[model samples]
Target: MKRIVFSAMAACMIVSACATAQDGTGLSKKEKKAGWKQLFDGKTLTGWHQFHAKPGSTPAWKAVDGTLFLDTDAKASGASGGDLVTNEDYENFEFEYEWKISPNGNSGVMFGVNEDKKYGATYSTGPEMQVIDDAGHPDGKNKKHNSGELYDMIAAPKFYAKPVGEWNKAKIIKKDGKITLFLNGEKTAETTMGTPEWQELLNNSKFKTWKGFGEYPKGKIALQDHGDKVWYRNLKIRQL
Candidate 1:
């Protein structure tokens, strides 16, 4: 059934050369006016690819029911795959997505990633807007590692995460060297990168030893594959 659906979609793409916003996966008129772009087109991994996986490797990621999700079954069966990333890079932009995690699941959204030999994972060079099952996950015991926290460097003032299996809205805005994080309509974390204060925060954190960490001014956006089931949708990005 998945193949049939995708085959029809493939034919449509061949005819139209690309899917349109009418599918609810492409940029809407208003979003297009705002210079926003669609990162995932819901039906296919058009602008995305598996990270660190060798050529012809089966991707652990899957598009299902208009949601892109990490297929834990594939990983459990040892169908190896890594993080997922956008083909194009962005420097400063506003990215928004809706996500839902399985019980005790762990995942993250990373930006400013310099995907090179120097970095093994996106988190090695990019800052992650932490995503996880805030209530059921072991990491939830610490506010610093809970959902909406800036991974480790910064803890959100309040936990606004919904329960696992429920959709949550998140936004990460980076502009002019300043970054801000929003969860469920509330501002959670904000900081200026490359400043003495930012450097101090980095020095105090676990990433301090990685020489290339957070040094790049621009790079790609990525979704971490922590060997857990997590679904993402409505992925849209606009340059700031």
Candidate 2:
């Protein structure tokens, strides 16, 4: 009788814990156990928005063999604005993705991008996670242009990216005022948000000329084309 009462109490506690732990996404206990929510369905652009292109135009974003690929062949002359964004807005969260780039290609993943298209381009508003082929891309002329860096503003400690044509893992965590970048399971760069040093870096960056740069509190996420052939997979995010 004592064992039965103990089991009943434990079951009630588990139910209460689950009820309180269910997030806004209504994920099951098993799904939330991994602490990540899939941003892409791998089959369609369901929870994403394709902007900067024409109203009905879709820019080279297609799912092939379970990988989301950006085929820039359709976009010649480097007519930019091949940025796709998430439907949700995030302030403090953890992001992870696997990417592969063609030789000499260029691309980026932008976060904190509060969409004010009337103001200017995406880079002017979002902080970019620089994505490029380290040894092959022209932007890869230095450590700042390499993968897993904070895109021209901060440089990674070392080149931890795999060669072109191979998948490389990357992660980003934004907790409170701290932001960290990771490459291939190693921490690369980190900075405190809204600090004088960070503001100074922004003022000196290419985005300096643009208005409202890194001034948003929270915003949607964006994937940039930048006239590069890049592929992304297993993109996931977890809110803190």
TM-score, every prediction: 0.88, 0.82
Q: Give the TM-score of candidate 2.
A: 0.82
Worst-scoring 10-residue span by lDDT in model 1: 17-26
Deviation (Å) of 48 in candidate 1: 0.8
Per-residue alpha-carbon lDDT of model 2 for 14-81, expressed as tens digits?
99787667454544565567677988777777788765446666557777776778877756634333
Off by over 4 Å in 2: 1-31, 76-81
The sequence of per-residue lDDT tens digits that candidate 1 reaches over residues 1-240 is: 999999999898866643334445467565687888888888888899877658877787999998998898987676776899999988889999999999999999998888787678888898888899887778878757888878888998888899889999999999877999999998888899999989988988889898877888788899999878999998999998
lDDT (Cα, 0-100) at 27 in candidate 1: 71
Model 2 residue 39 CA deviation in Å: 0.5
| Total backbone collisions for each predicted model | 0, 0
Instruction: Give the whole-model CA lDDT for all candidates, comma-separated.
Output: 0.86, 0.80
lDDT of model 2 at position 234: 81
**Clashing residue pairs found in predicted model 2:** none
